[model samples]
Target: MTKYRLFTPGPVEIPERVLAAMAKTDVHHRTKEFMQIFSSTAEKFRQLVDSEHSPLFLACTGTGALEAALINSAQEGELCLYVSAGKFGERWGKIARRAGIEGVPIEANWGDSPALSKVRETCAAHPEAKVFCIQHCETSTGVLHPIEEIIPMVREECPSALIIVDSISSITTSSLSQRKLGIDILICAAQKALQLPPGLTILGLSNRAAERIQEGSPHSLYFDLKHELKNQAEGSSSWTPAIAHILGLGEVCQMIEEEGLDHMIERHNRLSKLCRFGLTQLGCTPVAEEYPANSLTPATPPEGIDAEVLRKKLQNTFHVLIAGGQDHWSGKYFRVGHMGSFSEADMRMFLGVLYDALSEMEAKLPEKAEFETSLCSFV
Candidate 1:
C-alpha cells in the first residue's frame, strides 16, 4: 500500500524515528524496565506543559481526555460556560449535555474570536459555574483564542470556576505554560505536535484542580482522575497503556530535546506562513487571515471552485493529503497542516505538488509568485 504524504492536521506524517521507536520490542507494563521508560516519558510530559506534577497518561484521544476532565471536575447538573466559536468549542456543550450539565456558550461566528466582555459577563452571571471550557486553538476554523487575556478575567470574576483548556492541536506548535496561566486542566494528545500515531492522551492538572477532582467521585471508574493520580505517582498506570505510543512519544521528546522545543515551535509558526503564501500563489485566499493558528492555514479556492474537489484532487492525484473544512465549511475552504515533524523542506515539497495540481485543475490564479525558498529556509 502506498503511503500518502499527509498534509492533514493529524494523524500527520510521523517521522521515521518515532515509527522505529514504536516498533521496538514491547516491554511488560508491570516490569521494572517498563517502569523506567514510563517514569521518564511521564516527566517529558511534565516538562512539555511546564508543570511541577507529572502528567497522567490515558489510552484515548483528546476528545476522551476532554470527557474525562469534564466528568471528573464538574458535577452533573452543574452550570458550565464554554466557547462555541468553532466545532471543537461546541464539543464542550455536547459533552456537557451527555454528562447532564447545563453548558452556556459564549458564542461567536466561526472565524471570529470570542469577545472578552461576553466571556466576562457569562462568568459574572454564573459565578457558581463549575468550569469554563475552551480550546487553545479551535482546529476546525484555524482560530487561536485569546486564552491569555480570557483566563485572567475568569480567575478574577469567577474565582471558583476551574479553567479547562483543550490544547489538542496547539500544544507544541504554541508556547503554553500551565502554571503561568493558572489552568486547572490542560489536555493534549500524542497525534498532533508530538508527531506520533493516535491513541494516547496527555493531561496535566494544577494542584488545586487535582484536589477538586479527588473531592468528587467521577461517574466512571475508567475516567477517574483520582485513580490516575494515585497510580501515576508510583510510576505506573491504573491499566495497561498504549505502550508503543508512549515509547514513540519518548522518541519525540528526544527529538525535541535535540531540536530545542522553542525552535520547533518557531518552525511551525514559519511553516504556517510558508503554506499560506504558497496557497495564495496557487490561487486561494486565506479563510482565517486574522488571528490564525500557527498549526494550520485555511484557504478558500478561487470563486466557483469546490474546496473539497480541490482537496481530493491534491490527495488522490498528487498524493498530498491536506484537510477540507467541516460542516458548513466542508465545500467552502481547505486547510494545509504544517504542524509537527514538518520542516521547511517538507513544506516545499507539498507546495511544488500543490502548485502543479492547481495549474492542472486550471484554477484562475493571480500573477504567479515564486516560493523564494531562501527567505523561508530554516537553515
Candidate 2:
C-alpha cells in the first residue's frame, strides 16, 4: 500500500473537512443553490488575491488558466514577452508558441529569477508588446520572482502591455495583492496554498484586462475569459462545471477566511524558514537563497549522495515523501513542500526522517549541531 505522506509541490494533502465538503450531495450547475456556492467562492478568491474585481473559474489545471490569460489578453499577431526561469516558466513559452502568438522570451538561470533590469530593457525595446507574462513562483526551482519590482518597470516602459502572472503557487502564500500590484491577469489553482484537491482553477482579472478581451483573439473557446465572465454574471458556468470541486473550494475558502489570509501567509513563511534551517544544518544548500519560495524549498543534495535515492529512502522507509527536482536539476536537488495544512510538527517530522536518512547514508553532521540549529530556527 502507498502509505507515504505527500510533500510534492502540487496535489498536496487535503484537509479532512475540505474533502468531506466535497462529499456533500451534488447539485446541478444551473441551480440557484449552486450559484450561491459559486458566488461565495468567487468572493473568497477575490480576498485571496486581494482583488476587488471578479475572476474567471475553469475546470482545469493551472496551465489551462495560463492559456486563458494568454489567449484572452493578446492576439495571434500581437507581440507578447514570456519571462522564463524554470520548467513552469518554460511551459508558458511553449503555450504561446502553440497558440501561434508572436512571443519573445527572456530567460534567466534555472535557479535564479529573471533580472528586473533585463526585463525592463527588453520591454523598453519592444514598445509594441501587448502582454508580459511571468510566473509569481517557479515551482521547479523554488524561486520567487520580484513581480512587484518588475511590473512597475513594465508599466512605465511599456504602458500598453498587459501584465499576466501565473500565481499558481504563490497567490495565497506570498505577499502579493492584485489591486496593489496592478496585475492584469492573476491565475491560480485550488491545489496549492488554498489547501484543497486539484480540479478547480481560479483567475482574477482587472477591469483593464476585461476591456482588452473585447478586442478578442481566435485561440480560446472554453478557456475564454469573456465567455466565462458572461456565464458568471448569470450565476452559471459556460458549460458543465466541476460541482464537487467547486463545493470543496467553497469549504476551503471558509477555512481561509476564518484563519485570515495574512495569518495563512505567515504560517507558510514560518514553515519555510523552519525547513530551510533544518536543511542547512544537514549540509544541504538552497537553490535560490535570495528569493526562496514560501511554499517549497529546493535543496541541493549533499555531495556523494544521490538526490533521488535520498527521496526514495525517505518515502519507502520513513513514509515521508518529499519532491525531486525537475529538468536540468533533476537528481541533483530535492524539494520539500511546506504549503497547505502543514505545521511545525509536520516540518519536524520531515526533518527527523531526513536526519535519519542522512545518518544511514553515512553523511556526518557536526555532533549535535544539526538538531541544535534546527531548534533555534524552529522553536
Name the top TM-score candidate.
Answer: 2
Which ranges of candidate 2 are over 4 A from the true structure? 368-379
Candidate 1 regions exceeding 4 Å error are 366-379
Tell me the RMSD of model 1 versus the true structure.
Answer: 2.0
**Model 2 per-residue lDDT tens digits across residues 7-86:** 88887898999889888785888889889888888887787787757877888888888888888877777889988899
Q: What are the TM-scores, per candidate, against the unseen true structure?
A: 0.96, 0.96
Candidate 2 accuracy as TM-score: 0.96
State the lDDT of candidate 1 residue by residue for 1-379, as single tens digits.
7568888888788888899989978578888888889989999878878875778899998899999988888898888899999889999999999988889999989988878899898888988888989999898989989899999999988788889999988998988999998888999898888898889998888888888888877678899889888988887899888899989989998998899889988999988887877776666788667678989888888767889988888878888888999999999988888898787888888877876777777877543344444334424
For candidate 2, give the lDDT: 0.84
Q: What local distance difference test score does each model get?
A: 0.86, 0.84
